[model samples]
Target: MSDATLTRIAEALERLRPAPAQTPDWAAAEAFVWHADPDRLEPVAQVNRVDLPLLLGIDRARDTLLENTLQFARGLPANNALLWGARGMGKSSLVKAVHAEVLAQNLPAKLVEVQREDLPSIGRLLSLLRVAPVRVLLFCDDLSFSHDDQHYKSLKAVLDGGIEGRPENVIFYATSNRRHLMPRDMIENERSSAINPSEAVEEKVSLSDRFGLWLGFHPCSQDEYLAMIQGYCAAYGVKIDADTLRAEAIEWQATRGARSGRVAWQYFTDLAGRRGVTL
Candidate 1:
């Protein structure tokens, strides 16, 4: 080929190569994730959140979470929340549902779920969100740590609202079965082995105190469990007589040897499937 033609071809190939995307000004997005390797904020166009009404049996906790979330949405000072206590008691569900409720009201806040293993990346996440236009809810579900895991230190720093402090636009919400966000055995072991047993317990116990809001979820009574079932049935338009529903629900709870929102929902799903209904 002629030199001129080859040069023209090379120029065309270079033009065809994609240019790097601009580091988006955070104002353009309602939600984003921190991509650590690239050290950039990736915007999320759509979020998967449940409506608040669907979550039942935790009304007081729900109201508290909703208020805290709304305050954050409005650019008011809000505290980090630790939703702790009974298993399957709608702690995590409440956070997602509250996010949806606030968003439905046309609030600017967005929810970003970070896996428990991703705790160490929180500072990076906060850094990206600090200058963001929209408020952010950084949620970590089932967030307890074991004795050997030191990721909690990073979380502690993030929650301490470090030198730069937790980004003004972002708030942290975590759900765990343990109040301390650590296993009893792990805490106990530290107490047993440390030079100062009291200090050892305090070191681990203090992690939970970082969260200003502590919402505890207790086990629901039988009536509350049934109410949850009834609510689900009614909401889904599942047709079942009350007596039959109660009987089956009781049997299901008995077999599981426990009754919680999770168990109730599982039973409802099974019952719906058996009845050839969709939920």
Candidate 2:
């Protein structure tokens, strides 16, 4: 090719390359994920979250979380929430679903999930979001600490607002099976060997106290469990006889030796497959 033609081709290729997009207005994002290494916010264009109405069996807790989230979405004062309780009881699901619900109502806040291990980087996250155009619902699922873990201190500081305090536009929502977000044995061990036993307990116990709202999830009752099963059935259009469905759901729970929304959902999935129905 001629030199002039080669130069022209190069120029054309350069022009075809896309320019970097502007940093999105965070307020416009409904969901996001925290990237801690380089300290950045990555927007989630489409969040895979269920509608709030689909969650069942934990009526009181659900109502409480929804009310708090709604208030936050509406720019009203709302407390940080700690959802602690039985496994697979929809703690994390409720958080995500509630975020989606509130956003659907055209609220100004967005949801962002950070990893438990990334708690120490929260200060950086807060700094980034502090001035963003949107309010943020920061979530950490199954958050807990081991005996040797010191990151809890950072979390405590952040939740307490530290020197800068938590951002006015941001709120925290965490889910864990442990109320203290630490193992009972760890707390016991600390109490057993620490020079000041009460102080040791205080150090660990105080972390949870930072959250103004403590929503506990208990194992669902048998009737509630059945209601959950029915709810899923109705939502998914899985037709089954009531008596048979109840018998099978009861047997399923018995065989598993536990009952919760998760168990009911799992059983329904199995039942749907066995009955040759797609879920």
Candidate 3:
């Protein structure tokens, strides 16, 4: 073909292809949201999270994650953490809170949340974080893999595989209701379908094993739940008489048919509203 024809084809192909993702300006914010469609890091000037002390229950979890994050921020060796357990027990909240506390202590660290759906773009996100001027905590909330989802492979690669492994300056934290990062049925399906049942189950659930820290959150007791409510009330200055507060909190838990840090927060919001207090 003539040079002109070849040049025209090249131009058309370039237009058809998607634009390369923009490198993030990590210096702009302490928290960011990674969007994969356009592949950009959306800066968060303020993250939505309660103070670490406000998270009353899960004291063990709070302390453990905080120490791990603090070490990572201080340029000390720290392991990637997987916060997995009971729903609404503050798995995700603890991650954000820990990040905030670490920053408040003046440790150089940033939090960049990548939604569970964006696992496929983990490599791209890591590339942006790799060159960040300060240490980064790459967070993913409510993360789990299903039977047919191969995105887990990408996560596996980013965690520990291929030539460019996880960046030393970056650590990953994820929260899930599942300990294995896979559904029970999915694990069972793999066990039944594969020739080697044992290997299949291990292969399917092993992504979680990559994490050095496994902080499991169990269902909170009634007392723990009430403690969360009390903590919120004290922090936000929600004033309700002790008797009324206890009665209302009990009713709230009864109505919800569950007790957890999330349920406690919801009850506190309701109580504060009734008392004409803003949270």
Candidate 4:
């Protein structure tokens, strides 16, 4: 071919090839939110999370996650974690808090919040992180799987069971309302539909097994709830008499119909607002 023809072909090939994926400057922020459409990381300048000490009631869950994140930050061995349990018990909050705690310890770690719907793009995200310099926490909050949902399969393989495998520098942490990452009814449906009932249910439930650390958060007791309220009050210096605070907290839960760390924080926020205190 003539030199001009060869040059034209090379230009045509360049146009046909896809553009290289662009990752954000990881140093821009301590945390980011991953979006799939643009396949980019949105820097989270401010992460809305309570401090580690402010996380009350779920002490065991808090401590375990903090320890695991610390280990990961220190470049030690750590497992993928599943924080599962009751609603409004601070599962997501704990993850953010733990990341901050780890950073305070002088270990370099960055957090990336990935939505449940972004699981399909998780492989691409992993590919980017695999070559990045810093250690990252890939967090998915309020994660759960449904009967028709196949994104969990992608997550399962990336966590441990796939050819590409999980990136060494990335740790996956997810919080779910369901312990098994699926509803009982969905599992039952699989049982009824599949030829091998046991295997069918096992296949879905087994996703939880990929997580080495399964931290469970339960509903806080009245005292525990009150303790959470007090912790927030103390942390924010929302001063009030012990008797009045107890009475109001009880009334708040009674009207709300449930008790949890989330309710406690909500109650505290209202009380602080009325008292003209801002945290």
What ranking of all candidate models by TM-score puts the best one first?
3, 4, 2, 1
Which 10-residue window in model 3 sums to the lowest lDDT?
A: 17-26
- The C-alpha stretches of model 2 lying farther than 4 A from their native spots are 1-29, 275-279
TM-score of each: 0.85, 0.87, 0.95, 0.92
Could you give candidate 1's per-residue lDDT for residues 1-279 as a string of tens digits?
A: 999999999999988764433455656555565544435556777655445776777899999989998999998989899999999889988987888788788996767777777677677667656765667898888998886898888898668877767788888999999999998899889888999999978977898998999999999999999998888888888989999999999999999999999899899999889988885
- The predicted structure with the larger lDDT, 1 or 3, is 3
Q: How many residue pairs clash in each candidate?
A: 2, 2, 0, 0
**Candidate 3: tens digits of C-alpha lDDT, residues 1-279:** 999999999999998775667877878888989898778889998899888888876889889999999889999999999999988988889999898888789886888889888888888778777777878898989988877888888888667947887899989999998999888988888878899999888876888889999998988887788788888888889877878888889998899898888889999888888889997
Model 3 clashing residue pairs (backbone): none
Q: Point out the worst 10-residue segment of candidate 1 by lDDT.
A: 18-27
Residue 168's C-alpha lDDT in candidate 1? 82
Per-residue lDDT for 55-103 in model 4, tens only? 8878788888888888888889998999999999999999998998888
Q: lDDT per residue, candidate 2, 100-183, as tens digits?
A: 778678776789899887788787677777777777898988999997999898787558887777888888999999999999
Best by TM-score: 3
Candidate 1 colliding pairs? 161-165, 161-166
**Regions of model 3 farther than 4 Å from truth:** 1-5
Question: Which 10 consecutive residues of model 4 have the lowest summed lDDT?
Answer: 15-24
Relative to the true structure, candidate 4 reaches a TM of 0.92
